[model samples]
Target: MCPRCRGEALLWARVPYGWTNREGGRVEGRSGVVLCPACDARAPGAAALITWFHVHGRADDEDEEFVRLLVRWATGVSVPPLDEHAPEAENERWQRGDL
Candidate 1:
């Protein structure tokens, strides 16, 4: 989050990445491709991590530890691998209501 503007967490989706939000508007940030939805705060995010999130569908949404580590990752900081959160953690979210 931006220290000046208490922005929310960094969110990612399968959206087109452009230089500006709209009409070539200038954003105030340095060396970060990822943008915070609330305040447009820029944070460096790795492609590998983003790919992981896309493949896993944010399975650790409710995991506090995961969220903290995610924030760290967003800031271009190194964090340990998420071994605690295995594939099973995402199973419940994947089950459709077909029954």
Candidate 2:
């Protein structure tokens, strides 16, 4: 059972991090974190990242898209811009008086 959410199917992962400083100094480390897929609760180390992907990876919930949106908010991943184009098929039908 997960301490946070009391969920049974908790997922644990060791996330790795690596970075290089301006002087070419390399730093790397890993952190162990637990996630509750049932209730979207994450352990301490998991908070440093957007753990939605791990928590919701196995979910078949109908609200998955909403979850995705929330993940984008948490991760600062921007939503793709919508294409700006007229409905050409509908316009053509209207011009032909088919509507």
Candidate 3:
């Protein structure tokens, strides 16, 4: 799940097909689903899709940030707050390994 959009439900099943980098490099990686959040409030089809960018045997943190920013820009809504209503965060008696 994207750290920015913590509250939104992520669709982590959309595989990334391709990606381009800031240095004009194109790369491919293992096919896997993307983690994304839907912005139904602003638009019906607004979504932030997280994709992996493998460049020169390394993944850039900037690229990941860019994807996150892109999603917010496209959706026009701030990423939902994470764990705002989670029961675990609010529970004081729950132990880490209680489950």
For model 1, the local distance difference test gives 0.46
- Write candidate 1's Cα lDDT for 1-99 as tens digits: 534355643454232222444566844433333334444323354444444555765547687755654666555632233343556556655665322
Instruction: Give me the runs in candidate 3 sitting further than 4 Å from their true place.
Output: 17-25, 30-44, 47-99
Error of 3 at 51 (Å): 23
Write candidate 2's Cα lDDT for 1-99 as tens digits: 656567674445454555666688976756544454554434333343335455555533367664554443334322233233457877888999998
Per-residue CA lDDT of model 3 for 1-99, tens digit only, reads 544456544443333344556687875533433234333323323332222222222334467665564455344433233343577554643665444
Candidate 3 at residue 61, lDDT? 40
Best model per lDDT: 2
What is the Å distance of residue 8 in model 2 from its true position?
5.7
Worst 10 residues of 1 by lDDT: 12-21
**Candidate with the larger lDDT of 1 and 3:** 1
- Which scores greater on lDDT, model 1 or model 2? 2
Root-mean-square deviation per candidate: 18.2, 17.3, 15.4
